[model samples]
Target chain A: MIQAVVILFSVLAIGGALALLLTRNVLYSAFFLLLTLLGVAALFVLSSADFLAVAQIMIYVGGVLVLIVFGVMLTHKTDPLNRSNQKPNAVLTNHRAWLWPVLLAGSMFAVLFQMLRQGNFVLLNRAAKYQTTVDTIGRQLMAEYLVPFEIAGVLLLVALVGAAYLAMPERN
Target chain B: METSTILIVAALLFSIGLAVVVVKRHAIVVLMGVELMLNAANLNLVAFSQYDPDRLQGQMMTLFVLVVAAAEAAVALAIVLQVYRHYRTVQLDEVNDLNN
Candidate 1:
C-alpha cells in the first residue's frame, strides 16, 4: 500500500515538473509547480517527515508560489508592433529546444542512477515508521540547531525587506 | 518505499528541473525549475533522515534548505521584475546586451 503511494506521488511530482518544462505559458507553469510541491509534501509524509511536509506546503505553496504568480502577472510584456502576440505573458524563444537540456540533465540523471544502483546503506533498508517529528524538530531547532535557526530568521527578514525594496515602484 | 526508489525519483526530478532551467526562456519558468531542483534535494535529505537514529540531521538540513530556497525565490523574482521593467521583456535570450 505504501509502495503504491510512493510510486503515485513520485509520478505526480515528476509529471508536474515535466509539464512545467513543456508548457510555454508562465502562469500555467506556476500552477504546475503547485502540483510538484504538493506531491513532494506527500512524499515527505510517506518518508515519516510529517513536520517537514506541513512546512513544505505552508512555505512553498503559501509563500513562494504566491510570489511567483505575482511575478508572472506583474511582469506582463507590452509588445506594440507585434499585435499578433496576443498573450503578452507568453515567452516565445525558439532556441536550444532539445539538445543541451537533454544532454546536461540526462547525463546527470544517468550518473546518479548508476551511483544509487550500487548503494547498499544498511540502516536505510528498513521501512520508515510514521512518527510525529514536530516535537523532536522543535526541540532540536531550539537546542542543537539554535544558531542556524536564529540565522535563518535573520536571513528571512533581510530577504523580505530587500524584496519589498526591489519591487517598489518609487525606486524606478 | 525502497531508498533507491526514492532516490531515483529525486534524480528524475532534479533532471527535469535542470531541463526546465535550460530549455525555458521565461524567467519565471526558470525560477520554477530552480524550485523543483531544491525540492528534489529536500526529498533526498528527508529520505536519508528516515534512518538517522540520533538527531534527524538530514531533516534539519532540509529545513534550512527550505529557508534558503524561499529567500532565493524572493530575490530572484524581484530581479526578474526589474528585468521586465527595464528590458520590457522577460524572454531571457532577448536580454543579452551588457548596457542599454
Candidate 2:
C-alpha cells in the first residue's frame, strides 16, 4: 500500500510539474505549482518526514505561491482575459526551443541513472525502525542544530525586510 | 519500488525544471523552474534518508531547502514585480539595460 501511494504521489507531482511547464497563463502555472508542492509534501509525509511536510505546505503553497500570484498581478496591468495578449514576441520566437530542454534533460537523466545504478543504498524495512516522529525532530532542532536553526530564522527575517524594501514603490 | 525509481523521478523533475528555466522567458516561469529543481533535490534527500534507521538528517536538510526555496521565491518575485514596474515587460531579452 505504501508503494502504491508513492507511485500515485509521484504521478501527481510529475503531472503538476508538467502542467506548470506547459501552461502559458501565469496564474494557471502558479496554481499548478501549488499542486506540485503539495504533492511533494505528501511524499515527505510518506517518507516519515511529517514536520517537513507541514513546513512545505505552509511555506511553499501558502507563502511562495501567494508571492508569485501577487507578482503576476502587480506586473501585469491587464485582466486575465487580455493578459494572454501580452506574451512578448521573444517568447513566441524560437519555436524549436522545446527540443533543447528535452535534449538537455534527457542527457541529465542518463547521467543520474548511471550514478544511481552504481551506488549502494541499503534499504531497510520500515516496520523494524522506531518512528521518526516530530517530537524527535523538534528536540534536535532545539539542541545540536540550534545555531543553524536560529540563523535560518534570522535570515528569513532579513529576507522579509529586504523584499519589502525592494518592492516598495519609489517616492517622488 | 527500488531506489532507482526515486532517482528516475528526481531526474525527471530536475529536467522539467531545467526546461522551464531555459525555455520560458517569464521571470515567474524561471522561478517555477528553480522550485522544481529544489523539489528534485528534496526528493533525493528523502529517498536517501529512507536508507538509514537513525539520523534523519536528510529529512532535516529537505526542510531547510524548502524554507530557503520559499524565501527565494518571495524575494525573487518581489524583484520581478519591481522590475516590471520600471520596464513593463518580464522578457529577459528586452531587459538589457543592466548588461555591460
Candidate 3:
C-alpha cells in the first residue's frame, strides 16, 4: 500500500513538473507548478515528513504561487486571443539547448542512484522512530535552530520591505 | 518503488526546471522553473529524512528552503512588475536596456 502511494505521488510530481516546463502560457505554467508543488508535498507525507509536507503546501502553494499569479497579472494584460503569441516556439527552436540539461541531469541521477544503491537506506523500519510532527519541529526550531530561525525571519522582513520599495509607483 | 523512484522523479523535475529556465523568455516562467528546482531539493531532503531517525535536519532544512523560496518569489515578482512598468513588456529578449 505504501509503495503504491509513493509511486502515485512520484508520478504526479514528475508529470506536473513536465507540464510546467512544456506549457507555453506563463499563467498555465504557474497553475501546473502549483500541482507539482502539491504532488511533492504528498511525497513528503508519504515519506513521513508530515511537518515538511504541511509547510510545503502552506508556503509554496498558498504564499509563493499566489505571488507568482499576482506577478503574472501585474506584468501582462489579459488578452484571451494572445495564445498564439504565448506559444513556446522560441524555446523549441534550439534543439541543442536540451542537450546540456539532459546530460547534466542524467549524470547527476546516475551518481545519486549508485550512491543510494550502495547505501543501506532502510525505509519503513527507520520511519517508525522519527518524530516528524509539527510540534516536534516547532520545538527544534525554538531550541537548537533558534538563531538561524530568527535570522530567517529578519531576512523575510527585509525582503518584504525591499519588494514594497521596488514595486511602489514612482512619484515626481 | 523505493528511494530510487523518488530520486528519479526529483531528477526529472530538476531537468524540466532547467529547460524552463533556459527556454522561457518570461521572468515569471523562469521563476516557476526556480520553484520546480526547489521542489526537487525538498523531495530529496524529505526522502533522506525518512531513512535517518537520529536527525531531522533534512526536514528542518526543507522548511528553511521553503521560507527562502517564498522570499525570493516575492522579491523577484516585485522586480518583474517593476520591469514591466518601466518597459511595458516582460519578454527577456526585448527588455535588454541593461544589456550594455
The best candidate in terms of TM-score: 1
Candidate 1 lDDT? 0.87
Model 1 CA deviation exceeding 4 Å by range = A78-95, A170-172
Error of 1 at A84 (Å): 8.1
Candidate 3, residues B1-100, lDDT tens digits: the string is: 4556787687778767877777777888888888888888888887777665545787888888888989898889888898888887887777888743
B46-90, model 1: which lDDT tens digit per residue? 999988736999999999999999999999999888888888888
On DockQ, the leading prediction is: 1
Off by over 4 Å in 2: A79-96, A123-132
Model 1 TM-score is: 0.93
lDDT of 1 by residue, A25-90 (tens): 677888889999999999999888999999999999999999988888888854667667455445
| Model 2, position A98: C-alpha lDDT score | 80
Greater-lDDT candidate between 1 and 3: 1
Q: TM-score for each prediction?
A: 0.93, 0.88, 0.85
User: How do the residues A145-169 of candidate 2 rate in per-residue lDDT, one tens digit apiece?
Assistant: 8888988898899889988898899
For every model shown, the clashing-pair count is: 0, 0, 0
Lowest-lDDT window of 10 residues in candidate 2 chain A? A88-97
Off by over 4 Å in 3: A78-132
Q: Lowest lDDT 10-mer window, candidate 3 chain B? A: B47-56
By the TM-score metric, which is better: model 1 or model 2? 1
